[model samples]
Target: MPETSGVPALAVEAPGMEPHPAMKRRAALGLALGALATPALAQAPWPNRPIRLIAPDAPGNGNDITARLLAPQFEAMLGQPMVVDNRPGAGGRIGVEAAWRAAPDGYTFLIGNAGSNGINAAIYKDLPYDLVTGFRPISMLVAGPNVLVVNRSTFPVSDVASLVTMLKARGDGYAYGSGGVGSSAHMSMELFRQRAGFVALHIPYRGTPALAQGLITGDAPVAIVNLVNVMPFIRRGEIAALAVTSLTRWPELPEVPTLDESDYPGFETMAWNGLLAPLGTPEPIVARMHETVQKIATNPMIADRVKLLGGQLVASTPDEFAARIAADVAKWRDVAQRGDIRAE
Candidate 1:
C-alpha cells in the first residue's frame, strides 16, 4: 500500500439517513419559520390599500351622497383613501351584490337604501345575496322621509284624509308611479293603501326622476319621492305635496302633516340611508367606520345641508341599525302579503 493515509477509508452511507448536523439545523430553522409565518399572516393590519364603498343607486342619489360625504373623513381617520363605486341597476341589486361579493377584508363596503336593505328581501322573489347573512351591519348614517306628491292639476287631493277619501270614491281610477315594482316607494304606497283599505294602480319606472317626471307631466297623477326632489317643484307650483310618511313632520315642511297623525294613525314609511360592509370584516374597522359616519352626520355644517335637503341624521348604533332593518323587513313582509304585491 503506497503511503496509505493514517485515516482508514470510510464506508459508503445508505441512501437516506439523518441529515448532517449543520444541514439538519437549517431544515429545522425553516420549519420553525413557517410556523411563525402563519400567525404573523393572520395578524396583519387591515386595509392595505384603498377602501371601496359601493353605492347601489346613481351618483346623485341619497345613498351615494352619504358615502361621498363620509369618504374624506374616513380617509383621514383610517389613513387610507376611500373610493366610492356607483353600481346602479335592478333597483340596487347590482351594487348590493358588488358589496356582498367583495373580499371580507374590511376594505369593501356598501351604502344602501331602504329598498336594498329592508324591502328587497320581502319584494324580490329571489335575491342573489342574503341581507341578514351576507352583510355586516356597521351603521346608519341618515334617515330620510319620503313624501307623497301629486301633479297640481290631476286627482285633486291635498292631504292624507283627502287622498283617502278620493281613493274611496274613485277606487282604482287613480294611479301612482314608483322607481320600480319592488322599490321602497312602491312598498310605502302599498302600505298606505293597505292601511287606507283601498287599491290603486301602480306604474313602475326606471328611476325616481322618471317617476317624478311622470307626476309632473300628468302621465302618472301621483308619486312619492324624497321631499328634496319635490320641494323645488312644490316651490315652483309644479307639484303639490300631500303628506310626509315619517312619524314626525319634517322641519322644512312643517306645515305638511305626517301620514300617521293625519288619516292613518300608525302610517309611517321612510327610505333611509346607511353604511354596511361585507360579512366577516374586522370589527375594529367597522367600529372606526361607524364613528366616522356618526361624526359626519352630526357635524353642524353637514347637518344643516342635510336638513335643507329633507334628510334627517340617523347616526344610530350598529345594534339599533340591525333592529331597524329587522323591523322594516317584518313590516314590509306583512304589507307584501296583504297587498298581494309580487315581483313583476
Candidate 2:
C-alpha cells in the first residue's frame, strides 16, 4: 500500500525513465484498483453497495408485486438493500431496455415477466431487445394462474363446463375482456377459447383494475384475469370463478376447479416472473444469486406469502427458465397468428 497517495491513483511512467520505489507501489495498486472499478466505480468486492432490481411495469402491477416479494429475501441473502426500480412504459420495453442497458455487474438485475420476456417477443414485429440472448436467465421466481371469471349479474355460467357449453353453442358470438390484446390475460383467455372450440370479441382495457371493473360492470360477459387483480371482487361475489389455469388447483382458491380438471386436460398457463442478469454479468455472481433464489423460494415464510398472493414459488434453473420462456413465446406466437390478434 502507498501511504503518501492515500487513494488509488494512477502513476504515469515515461518511456525512458525508471520510476521511484514509491511510484512503483502506487502504480501497482492503481492498476489493480482500475481493474476492480469496472461497474460501480469502486474498488470493493461485488455488491459493496445497494443493488437495484428492475421491475418492468408500473407500481402495483404484477411485476411490482413480485419485486417487493423477492427484494427482502435477496437483501437478506446478499447483505445489501435490493431496491425495486419501476420503469413502466411502451408495453414494458422501457423497463426491459433500462435493465439491459445497465452494467453487467452484480449490482443490477431485472424482474422479467411473461409480457416482457414472453409475449412481446412473439407478437411484436420488431422488439428493441432479445429475451433469449439479451439477458442472462437467473431463475424463475414465481408463477400465478389466471382465473376464468364471469360477472354474476351478466353471466349465467357457474362452472367451466357450463361456460364451455354456452360459448360452444353460441360459437364465436361471446365477448371477453382482458388487460390488453397482447397481455398475458388476453392470451390466456384466447388459449382457453381455442381449447374449448370457441371464439369471442376481445375488449381490451387499459390495466388490471380497469379490466376487473369492466368484468363487474358487464363490459364483457366473461374474462380470464389475474387472480391477484380480482380477489376482492370474487370475495364480494361480484364475479364467479369458473376455473383456474394452473395444472392443478390453486391452494388459495381450492374450490375453484382447474381447467385441466374441468376437462381441458394438461391446460396450464401462468403470469410468471423471473430473475435476469445483464448479458455480460459474471458467471460466479449469477450462480451465487441463482442458489440464493432457490433458498428464498423454499423459505417457509416466503412460501406462505407467495401462496397468500395466489402464486407458486418456482425457482427454476437458468436453463429451465430459458426453455420455459422460449416455449411461452412460441405458444403465444401461434395463438396470436391463429386468432389474428394484433398489438395495439
Candidate 3:
C-alpha cells in the first residue's frame, strides 16, 4: 500500500509462468555459447580444401613431374589433396606470374626450378615479378645431372675425352642442337664448348622434342642435354651418355664420371626443382610444409622412381635453397654474359 507503484509485483509472478533469475542468467549464457560456436564451425583450418600447386610447364616437364611426386606425400601428411595445376608458357614467366599474383593464402604454391626461376631470372629482362623477393623459398625437391649425350650409332664417342677429341677436331664443322637459344640445353652446350676449347655450330629447334628428334636423325650429332630427357633412348642404344655435368656421378649412371672429375675439373651444372610459395604466407604453414617434405624426401618409392627416371633426391632446407637460387642466378648470369646467351 506504501507504493503500489503502478507495477504489478506479486500478481505478475505466477508459479512457473516466468523464468527464475538464475534461469534467465543460464539462458543468456546459452545464447553467448551458440554465438561463439558458430564462428568455430564456419571457419576450418588452413588447408580446408585442396591445395593447388602450379607447375610452370607441360604435364611431362620437369616442374610438373616434381609436383606430381610431391602431391601424394603432401596429401598423406596434410590430410588434404594437393593438386598440380600445369600452366606452361613464356619460359615459365606466365606460370610464375600466376603464382606470384595468387593470394598469399597457404593453399597456393609454385613448382619452380633452376631454369624457370634461376636461369630465367638472369636471362629475361624486365620480368613482372621479383624472383627472389616475391616468393617464399620452401625447399629443393630433386636435382640431377645434365649429361653430354650423342647419338650412339651415329657418333664416334664413348667417353668425355673421346667427345672432346671429336669436338676439337671437327671445330665449327660440328653442329649441335638445343631446345632454343637460351635454353639450359643451349647453355650447357655453350659451357661445354667454352670449357673444352672447341666450337660447335648451334642448331636451334622449337623444343626438346625437336632437339631429340634432331639428335636421333643425325640432323645434329652431339648435344649437351639432361640425362633424364633422353633416358629411354639411351637405354634403347640410340643415345650415349658421355659425361655428367654434376659435381658427383649420378647413381643410376654410376659408370659415367662427373665433369668435375674429368679434364673440365670444377665444371658443374644441374637440373634442379624446388617448391615456393607467394610472399607473406604464414610462417607456421611454411614450417609445416618444410618439415613434411623433409620427412618424405627420402621415401623409398619416390627415391626408386627418381633413380629409375634419372634424378637425384635433394632435400635441402629453405636457407640452402635460397642460397642456391642466388648462386645459380649469378652463375647463369656469368654464363650468359660470356657466351652471349639471351632469350629472344
Candidate 4:
C-alpha cells in the first residue's frame, strides 16, 4: 500500500521491539487475528459520513448560491449528505483559512471564487495558506462577467466610449462603488481605469447589495458589479449597463458591448467559482469528486438553472482549473500592485 505523510500503515509490531518466548507466542496469535480483521476494514468505502463544503462568502452571494445549488446533486451522486458552511468575513479570508486548516480528508472541501482565491491571494501579504499549494483544485464550476452600470438618474454617459470621455473630463470628481477594496468588482474597474487613462474615487461598500444601493441612491453614480447581482436593477430601468468586462458580450445583456470590442482590446475579467480540497487529499477521492461535480455542472437541468442565475458554465478539469487559478492570481497581483490596493 502507498504511504501518506500523516497516516500510518497497518503493522503487526514495531521494529526493534522483540518479545520473549511466551510473549512471542501470544503476539503470533494476535497477529493472526489482526490479519483476519484487516480485509473488512480496508474494504470500507469513502464518504461513509457527511461531507462539509465551506463557502467563504455571505449567503445569497454568488459563491453561496452556487454551493447551495450543487450540494444536493453532490449528495445524490456521492451517496453522502453535502453540507454548506457559510463563513463570511475578512474578504473571504476567514472561511478560506478554516478550509485550509482542515484535515486532508475527503470530508471537508471549499467553494471559493476569484475574490477568495485570486484577488485576496494578491493583496493579503501574510495569508495563512498558499493559494496555489495549500489546496487541490477539483473543478471550475461557473464564470460570470462584471457589468459597468451607472445610475440612470445621475450619470449621463450612454456607452463605453462616452463613459470613458466623461470620466476623463471629470477626473477624480466622480466616484464608483464596489463590494470591497480587493473584490473582483474593485479590481475590474481598476483595470478599466488604468487602460482607459481615467480616474474615479472608489467608495467601498460592505457587500454587493450595499454597492447596488449606492448606485441606486446616487451616492456613487457608477459601479462595476457582478452581472447576476445588477441585471435585475438594469432591467427595472434603475440603472443602465454601459459595458461588460469580458472580451465577449454577456448573453443576458446582449445589447451591451464588451470593453474589448468597444475600445480596449483583449480585456477579459470574470468572477468564477470552483471546488477545492485541502492539499494532500487522497488522489482517488479527488478524482471521484471531480467526476461527480463535472457531471452535475454539465447536466441540462443544472445548466438551465445556472443560466437563470446569469452564470456561464465552465466545468473545467482539475489541471485546467489549477492553471486558471495561477493565471488569475498573477493577473490580480499585478493589478493590486499598480493600483496600490489593500484590504480595509
Using lDDT, give the best candidate's number: 4
**lDDT pick, better of 3 and 4:** 4
- What is residue 305's positional error in candidate 3, in angstroms? 1.3
lDDT of 1 by residue, 62-142 (tens): 788877877887887678899999998877888998888888888888888788888888888788887766788888877
lDDT of each residue in 1-344, candidate 4, tens digit only: 67563323344557887656776676677677767787988768999999999999888888899999999999999999999999999889999999999999899999999989988888899998889877999999889898889987777778888777777888456899898899888999888888888878999898888999999999988888888888789999899998898888788889999888887898888889999999999999999998897788778998888888778777789999999899999999999899998775
Give the winner by lDDT: 2 or 4: 4
User: What ranges in model 2 sit over 4 Å off?
Assistant: 1-44
lDDT of 2 by residue, 209-234 (tens): 88988888888879888887888788
TM-score of each: 0.85, 0.85, 0.85, 0.88
Error of 2 at 191 (Å): 1.5
lDDT of each: 0.81, 0.86, 0.84, 0.88
Name the TM-score of candidate 2: 0.85
> Cα deviation in Å at residue 177, candidate 4?
0.6
Q: What's the lDDT for candidate 3?
A: 0.84
Instruction: Select the stronger candidate by lDDT from 1 and 2.
Output: 2
Per-residue lDDT of candidate 3, residues 14-38 (tens digit): 6768767876776677677767887
Once fitted onto the true fold, the runs of candidate 3 whose alpha carbons sit more than 4 angstroms away are 1-44
